[model samples]
Target: MTHDLLRLATAGSVDDGKSTLVGRLLYDTKSVLADQLDAVERVSRERGLDGADLALLTDGLRAEREQGITIDVAYRYFSTATRSYVLADTPGHVQYTRNMVTGASTAELALILVDARHGVVEQTRRHLAVTGLLGVRHVAVAVNKMDLVDWDRSRYDDIVADARALAARFDIEDVVAVPLSALLGDNVVERSAHTPWYDGPTLLEHLEAVPVGTDPATQPFRFPVQVVVRPQAGEYRDYRGYAGRITAGVVRVGDEVAVLPGGRTTRVVGIDLGRGDGTVTELSEAFAPQSVTLRLADDIDISRGDLLADPGRPGHVTRSVGGTVCVLSERPVRPRDRVLLRAGTRTVRAMVEEIIDQLDIDTVDYRRAPQELRLNDIGRVRVRLADDLPIDDYHELRRSGAFLLIDDADGATLAAGMADAPDRYAGADI
Candidate 1:
């Protein structure tokens, strides 16, 4: 039997031991192969180190190894007896903030690392703010390098307090802090005797046991049509089905659903799942994250960009959307900038209606009315779409509420945005 999976992301300031911590997790989990261990050991000796540098296990890029810093998002997979894990080790440099955003976008939990000596710094606050904005519900704070502080409980407590306070400001309530030295493998996978004062579960323990994913019953059904399945000549010749992955909630045969941007109501007559060999399996019901072709009772003109959702809980259909954005491109986003907004499988032409404010990451406050959003800048903006879009607040459903801004001319992605009300982050309550 397969265990449940947990998707997690790591964020921290430069040299906060994010990579080392991840490397330690992979190494201690026995996820590393003998050849990989040999390679890391060989490189450690080349650097005149006594033993294998675990950080080398994750710093895969040559530039990163040379600079001893993470430059890109490195994803590593490992499984314990309890659960499987997907770890996205993101870059911590200020310039690579975009990379961190990309890595943490789909994360169910965030593992934030902090240097015990520094406590809560500006980058920590920035990451926490992003975590909150992205709606990551759970957080695990790792107060790393406890050995460097001589395993001082007072110092560890101070850091954890400050980190907790910072996390609270971002509305991250489910937070757990662990004091450990990632380099020495203390309190990571194993309980370290060096820190006998700490009683909480180890980092890996928390990760394995943390509650993940949402209940389909509680969430409203959301299905973004990816493609219209219509075979010109086949056994299923007369069939017309909407093919896509269910983003949220559940749907069953005879359940009423409404296709959005049109608001046409219909009952799900059948749910079909394709077996790779041209054979299709029909299911009585389906839920979020499942890919299936749905046949509706009535043939509504649904296309790739349309949304089929619970009619009672159908999302907003509007030409305007306001939310926070994290600029990811080198090109700045200014008022009246034309861009493409891609939400799920749907992409639409959009314009930057206004730049509401720029977030001061250090202070966790907004600087009202910024002229332009440059690379790595997080701010609020209003966008006017050329066509009406069935948008939802990110807080409602993360998959449907998130969108990407692309440069209209060059087709380069400019920013990652979360759909929300304008006043959502207008105050310190953000």
Candidate 2:
């Protein structure tokens, strides 16, 4: 069988050793080059450390190195005999929540690191909330720095229980808790003999085994138009094609599709994957993931930012989107505020019709009827998209289920929201 690639995000609070865990995974899998190891070792010696500082492998910027903090989402790739992996080492600092969002947007799983001594802190909960909201299905909670806590099993169990409780509130069902010390490399790559009471697999072992990217053959077809392909200068002048990644499901020659929002349906006359003859015809077969140009049977006004969906199972979307929002900026998100509502490929001007509620993550309850949303405050807001976008509930397709709000004037990327169905989450009082 072909070894599949798994994309995951590493998350936790500062000092939880997210970087070290990532480094250990890369190092153990024999992915680190000699030059990279030498660089980290040289830096470790300058800092007066006894061994190479594996965290140095990720904290790329000078500011990050000097402050001993991660400021950006560092991407690292590694592969074992069983599977290949792309790791997104996300920021641990509380203020860098935006980076976490970016890192986790494409992750199928999240490896959450926590200090065994600190147990469950606010930052841990925050990261978990973000992961859940992002629709990550699998979680491997690595309780790091366990040596500092004397590798106590009771401490590990307590943290595990607390994390499971938190995971429950956000609809994360497949959570695997493991104990590890990233600094000491316990249960990260090699199973540690020091922790005799623990029996779970190492973080590396679990990652190698957890399934990612189920076959999209069963999902409903969706293609978000990225750029309209019209090479006006060449012989392809008359060729009009919709270019985008297939978010889910299948598409093949002669299959009927609908141009979302416009609702003009067409048939897929050709499918090109950008290489080799690249035209797969046979409406019955499932087309895999690849950037392809889809030529429709009819040219009924389709362009970029339009949705191409399977006519059989068009996205059951709501006209009015209600969702929980977190104002990342210091500015407040007041009621009736107007912002751009982007769902999937389509972006529409939307109004903040109402503030239905605010969520206090610590208490797991909603503050019903909050007047305004402050920075980092999670609340329920209703935004009516200027036009209906073909989108599924966040619970359906994570890729098409959420959107980013862009400021009209300065083009600032504002809050990220999980789009709930229309008028559906009004009772999300928490």
Candidate 3:
């Protein structure tokens, strides 16, 4: 039985022990098999290590096999008596910022590792800013290599203070700090007797007890119809459903709904829930975060990329949008740049209307009227869609509102943007 599930992601600078932290969580939780542990032990000895190497457990790709580093996102699943965890261990290099976005999308908490000797670096601040932008409410800061710093309270407190200041700039609500030696297994899973000055919870303790929930049933129902299910086999010839995941809210039987882009009105007739083994329908109330087959009261011009939302809670539709941008490619983004806009499950043609400003992270200076956004540079811009499309404000609903800019020729994702009110949010330094 799936009692409770918490999706989490791990991020930090390269060689800051993100993979090692994931390995520690799995090893101490007894999620790794004997054969896997034996193989890791053999490889550790071959590499001339003093003890078993846990980072080898997650660096599983052939490219990583040759480079000895994680180049893509690695997902790990484990369970305890209280809850189940879906851990997305993402690459930490500045070049792999795109992979971090893929992992942080659905995560409720972020684990940011910091080197005890380095205090706070630029990469650390970058990762923190993304987590805050993605709306992950909880964070765990692991001050690693404590043995190298002699487990000193002064060193640990200094790093904690720096991280706290960064979190404050992002306005993150929750923070937990743990002093550990990932290479030596100090305070990762079981609490270590090394830091008597630290009285806070261990890494796993915080994860196990963290409150994580993003429910659509409570807010408003938004079902972006992905497929029109019309089974024409056996006795199911009359079956029909608008298939898609619930992006924001809920859709229940007899609830009034609006189909957008086509602007059709109807009521939900029935719902069928799939349980992996077989499909089940409770036939009454269906809420957000639940993927099910929805039957409508009337047939309309609904198709893929169409939206199903609450009649009164429909999203804002506009031909133009404005938000902050971070150009991730080597080529700079300039005015009138042509790109494809991906909003939720819908894709539309769009063009870069203007570059309003550029951000200097080192000095926090937002320069006015920048010409282009270079690689790893943050800026503000305006985008004009070819046709009017519905997108929600990021502060209002994350899943229903965020968008990405993709290169039409090579299909490379260039930028990630969230919709805000006209002229962008007044306080969106994120």
Candidate 4:
């Protein structure tokens, strides 16, 4: 059996040891090379530190290394005997909250760190809120810096209680709280004898065992055509195929599908797995995340940016959508502002019809009628698209429900958007 791959993002306030925990996981897992270890040791000695600074493993930026803060999203990849892992270490600073959104958007799990000495702070709440908004189902709260608290069971328990309450406010269901000291490597990779009262899997163990969800075959099918392949000269000269990655569910030969926005029904005649060596293998079926070419029985008008979906449960087709958005660019977003909405492979012109409200991260309430949204502001906004779009509720179908707002002036990304109102905060205060 093939071990499944887990994608996770780590977030925390500045100095909460997010990088240290990631570095320790890599170090203890034997994923780091000898030269990397030697370099970390050299840097530690240069900085007058007694031990190797494991945080150096993920803090690759010079500014981060010198200033001792994560400024951008840093991705690290590693694998163990049982599973492969992709870790996104997000920035902790409030100003870089946009980076956190970018990192956590595609993650299946979120590793939230809390300083045991400081407990939960404003930034902690902000990150937690963002994680909830992104629809990340599973969360692991690492109560870090436990060594500073002398492994006090009461302190750990109190912190865990607080963290759980905060997570609950966001409707986060699966939460595992682990008390560990990233610097000392206690309860990170291996169980620490320092805490006999606590009985839970170590951080690494929890991550390895967490169940992401069912196979893509169980979900609704969604495919956004990225390229229409037509070969003119070859043994297969008449071959015409729609090539794209399956974003959700599965598609099999002879399965009936509908072209979205056009609502045209067709049957999948064949499937091809491109080997990228000028050859291809015919497939009986293909599922989510796989890049494959599909041939339809009817040569209906299909092109890039068109969606192919399960006809039985096609996605929503509409011109107006309301959801939460995190403004990323320095320029503010206001009513009547024209922007480009990129959802899946389709980019359409859209207008900001209304600024519903901005989220008060601290209170978990909506601040009514914000005139405009600035950088790092999370708010509910309604958009009017120039053309009808086939979209899904973000909570139900993440791939089909998410979108991005792009500035038309220079093609800069302005915000990351979701398809429906946040469940927890819907109708919150009008």
Say which prediction, candidate 2 or candidate 4, comes out ahead on TM-score. Answer: 4
TM-score of every candidate: 0.97, 0.93, 0.92, 0.97
User: Scored by Cα lDDT, where does model 2 land?
Assistant: 0.81
lDDT of 2 by residue, 1-430 (tens): 6789999998889988888888887777889999999999999998899998888888889999999899888889899887888889989988887778888888999989888888889888888888888889899999899889888988999999999999989899999998888888889889999888888899888998898895787888888999888758677788777888888888878789988877788888877666567644323343546667788888678777888888878876556877766677666777777788777678888888888888776786677887787766677777777777777777777777777766766767668787776546446433
> Which ranges of candidate 3 are over 4 A from the true structure?
62-66, 230-238, 274-282, 328-331, 423-430
- Tens-place lDDT per residue, model 4, 139-256, is 9999999999899889989888888888899899999999999999999999999989989999999988998655897799999999998867877799999999999999999999
lDDT of 1 at 111: 96
For candidate 3, lDDT tens digit of each residue in 1-430?
4469899999999878888888988998999999999999998899898888899888878688578678898899988878899999999888887678778878889999999988888878888877876777888999998989899999999999989888877678798889998887888888889988888888888888898786655687788888899868888888888888887776779899988866678999998887877766555877767788899989777888888888797877788888766666777788898999888788899999988787666554568877788776667788999976777877678887788888988998888776766645566653
Query: Which TM-score value belongs to model 2?
Result: 0.93
Clashing pairs in 1: none
Tell me, what's the RMSD of every candidate? 1.8, 2.5, 2.5, 1.7
Q: How many residue pairs clash (N, CA or C atoms closer than 3 angstroms) in each of the candidate models, in the order given?
A: 0, 3, 3, 0
Query: Given candidate 1, what's the lDDT at residue 166?
Result: 84
Q: lDDT rank, highest first?
A: 4, 1, 3, 2
lDDT, candidate 3, at 195? 89
